[model samples]
Target chain A: MRHLIDISDLTRDETNELIETASDIIVNPDNYTNKCSRKKIATLFYEPSTRTRLSFESAMLDLGGSVIGFSSAQYSSVSKGESVADTVRTVSCFADIIAIRHPKEGAALVAAMNSPVPVINAGDGGHNHPTQTLTDLLTIVREKGRLTDLTIGCCGDLKFGRTVHSLITAMARYSGVRFVLISPDELVIPEYLRNGVLKRENIPYVETRSLDESIAELDILYMTRVQKERFFNEADYVRLKDSYILTPDKLAHAKSDMRILHPLPRVNEISTAIDYDPRAAYFRQVRYGKFIRMALILKLLEEAEE
Target chain B: MIIGSIVNGIVIDHIPAGRGMELYKLMKLNELKCEIALIENAKSEKLGKKDILKIGEMLPFDYSILGYVDSRITINFIENGKRVRKEHPSMPEILSDIIKCKNPRCITTTEQELPHKFRLSDRESLSYRCVYCESKAQSN
Candidate 1:
């Protein structure tokens, strides 16, 4: 009964295998279309996310598996005070696997505790999101042709960006990978992650306020939105919101082959004009997300049989 | 004044007043076959208020149980109306099977088959953390 509650749960080989499987799925989508013909997937999204929910639904539908579950807490029995343990237990009786996304920090772990089937953590509150990490890994592999020997630049809201944290942790395992952390002083990466993962692993990284200066040296540019609600003071939020915006002019300094990535639902962090640029890989990354999810469903179901 | 202390018995002193009965309940002293006397609130210059428990036998007990509630207990081995040995509370080495980790994401908290394990990270601060999730506790 293996569960992916964190990114570290997968070893280096297992991670690569998943990426390879996703690539294979991308090449010949019609060949493995009926892998899970009679299987069922239950998506229990406690938080309202149109993008992630639709991605999971599309992935399951592509695999020929039926999808059934609620998209929000208000529509679920959770609004009537049902515990996560009880809800997962009940859902497991009908579905072969479950994907859960919740606002509480540890709600997915709680569901995994009581679920009879394997539980996949879609996303837990500002905590770890293993699948998004998988998507980012697939993107890096496809774009760069390798995962090592690259300078990855992560800009904006590093302090609260779970995607950035997960990507950094996963990339630290590879060789010759350096990091350029670009953000304002208030939203810089927290000391725990800096000291615990980066410093302890002896990974070379530099903190900078200028994104344009470091953009030319990067092989990957990962941009995240600077959210307003995360700030305690509105004035502080307004002051630093525009500091990390990526416009087409900013792309002039970047390398010709440098790939730009974002976990989308972009709010002016990367201008719409840059969407036409060949360097923007975020939309392609979304398609890769579905391919990898389809691969995941097949692998999990195969493992269940053995 | 529960007569003279018996030879080769354990004496617990300096417990906070009004908590003697609670300590007695915690230790289950009443179930023991040995004679026990629980002294009520007594005025002391150091503690200001204290209680004493005199047991008329060398009972098999671990003094570390007091590490959770309070650290003010003193144990003495009285022999022929004289203190032969004394022991004071020291910080425990490993805290387990006593308190559960509050982090619901912790492997120990989620896995039913796993045992709850924590290590004392800070001795002076009495801080403990779950070995799995790294959630901290002030005292346990």
Candidate 2:
């Protein structure tokens, strides 16, 4: 009964194995078309999400599995005051596996604790989104051709961006990886990540406010939106939302081969003008998301059988 | 300065000096109606000065809480005015309902029925993080 509650739950070997499986699925899609023909995936999203919810549905559909469950709390039994444990327990009776997304941190963990089937944390508030980390890893491997000895520049909301945090945790496992974390003073990386991962692992990293200053040395630039939902103060959200917009001017200083990545549904942090740039791989990152999820579903289902 | 010994009770010994009050408040000893003595800054050979707690009645005690507060704490069971057993409390791997998660986004905050759980993350620093949100537990 393994569950993907946090990025650290997957060892470095397991993460790499998932990346390889996702890559193989991309190259040979037909071979996996009926891997889960009779299986059903319960998509229990307690919050609003377009990309993640659809990615799970699309992944399940691509694997010949049926998708069930709600897109938001207002549409589900959760609105009727059903607890996450009860909802997951009920859903597990009808589904083969469960993929949960909740605004509250560790909600999926609660689901995992109660579920009989394997649980996948689609996204859990600003806490962890391990699938997004997998998507980013697959994208980096496909774009940069390697994961080691690279400088990753994470810009925008380093404080509450679960994607950035998960990516850092995943990347820190590889050798010779340094980080250039760019964010406003208000949105610096959390202390657990700074002290627990980077400092504790002896990984080299630099914190700065200027993305342009750090862009040139980066092999991969991971940008994130300053999520409004994470902020209790609307005034703080308004002030920090536009802290780092990736304009064409900013791209002029970056390495020619530097790849730009963002876990999508991005606001204006990335200018529309950079969409056509060869380095802009966020759209491709979204495509990689579906494949990685397909790989994850297959892996979990296979493990469930054994 | 003279705290009488109990005939049938428990004695918690070897708490670092000045931390007895903290342990008292944390254990909610004030809520108990039974006789209890908190001997603070008591002379000790091991700690030079230590805090000791004597409970006049044998109540269900969660020694895990004492271990989390201070691993050096020792518990002695007194029966018929004689020491029956001495137990050294060790740090528990998981702590449930001992401390509340302050992170507003944690699921335990909204689901009142959910037990507030924390996992011992770093033993060296005696750090525990909320199982729900991974926020560091605020030490009392």
Candidate 3:
């Protein structure tokens, strides 16, 4: 069975198809209300998440599918030391597909390996969140008009930001796309992503500490929170938590059409005042997240049947 | 010092000098009850200096493990004390349960039954990354 443990698991054409389907769904919501009638989705969230779990549930509900499963490890058999393999194996019998979110990296992959039905990785620690990348891709396609020929500036906590790595991997397939990586020295993109994807693929990119200097050249600014859970030291988290705050002054040099995006639950990274600005598309990005997930579920379930 | 040749065994040749013991240990040859001889820092025309291992019995094992350790090493099959066939093992594309992933957040850490698997990501650099977490394997 097919599983989306990483964004790269879906080829460029498949990704485009998902985007196209999501866009179509946005225009004609009524036509797909019963697309997943009598289908069931198991959401096995081993970690706490407000947006992703709800987004998956909402997407499944909107498609006329029912949702089952736990929201946290403490509430499930995982608290009694059940392996991801066993959990997914048991869940696969009841649900047509599974959406899993776990605190440990590669937990989703473990689930996918064991599950007979399709598995969707909601979020797997700081490793990968393919759906978020899909959502970001959809937002970029909707806001910026094209995925190609755009300079994306990713700011703050690029190190542990799974969305950033997945985005760069997905976008590298497109032509004329450049990146301006804006982050403090402590949290640059990982070497595997740097040398493996960017350098190996011959993609053009620039690394800078000054968000103000890089903001002007970007068509899209992806703001990320410096996640406290990723840091081993509390002092390090405190020092870097307020590294880059996007205020009105920072956007003075940015283009009028520059779309500001964030994988939200944002902690003061983007100022609340900027939420009123037309450039702030993070909220709209969340809505796009739901639609793209709907498209993903429809695609996975249909493919499973075939 | 002369080490006697085996009658019907396997000869491992062309191991880079100073790594014979590591390869032997890694392959778990110590567990074998058969006679085993390890000759280290032997003069070689091809490698300048090399190590050779002679096993007294024809044992079955995956040569890819040897290749993953050092691809330059070659294995020879002896039927009647003379070299009958020679084999060269290339680096394996995937390694299972050979090395442990050090990443604390990796699922392998919590799942005791899970095999530690790594894929050869960069051939030129000889870099292997964990199949699950994508963490680079530490060189021995």
Predicted candidate 3 versus true structure: per-residue lDDT over B14-61, tens digit per residue: 999998998888788999999999999999999999999999988888
Score residue A22 of candidate 3 by CA lDDT: 98
Better of 1 and 3 by lDDT: 3
Error of 2 at A164 (Å): 0.9
Estimate, for each residue in B1-140, the C-alpha lDDT of model 2 and write its tens digit: 66787999999999999989888887888998989999999999999999999988887867777888899999999999999999988888898888889888999877789998999999998999988888889864
For DockQ, the strongest prediction is: 2
| Residue A29 lDDT (model 3) | 95
RMSD of each: 6.2, 2.2, 1.4
Instruction: State TM-scores per candidate.
Output: 0.77, 0.94, 0.97
Q: Which ten-residue region of model 2 chain A has the weakest summed lDDT? A: A2-11
Question: For model 1, what is the alpha-carbon lDDT of residue A114?
Answer: 85
Q: Which of the CAPRI classes, incorrect, acceptable, medium or high, describes model 1?
A: incorrect
Q: How do the residues A54-120 of candidate 2 rate in per-residue lDDT, one tens digit apiece?
A: 9999999999999999998999978889899999999999999999999899898999999899999
| Backbone clash total, candidate 1 | 0
Model 3 lDDT per residue over A162-232, tens place: 89999999999999999999999999999888998999999999999999888989999999999999988
Q: Which pairs clash in model 3?
A: none
Worst 10 residues of 3 chain A by lDDT: A1-10
Model 2 interface CAPRI class: high
Q: What tens-digit string does per-residue lDDT give for candidate 1 at A92-199?
A: 999988899987656677788788788888887677788888999999999989999999999999987889999999999999999999998888998768987999
**Best-to-worst ranking by TM-score:** 3, 2, 1
Q: Which ten residues in a row have the lowest lDDT in candidate 3 chain B?
A: B63-72
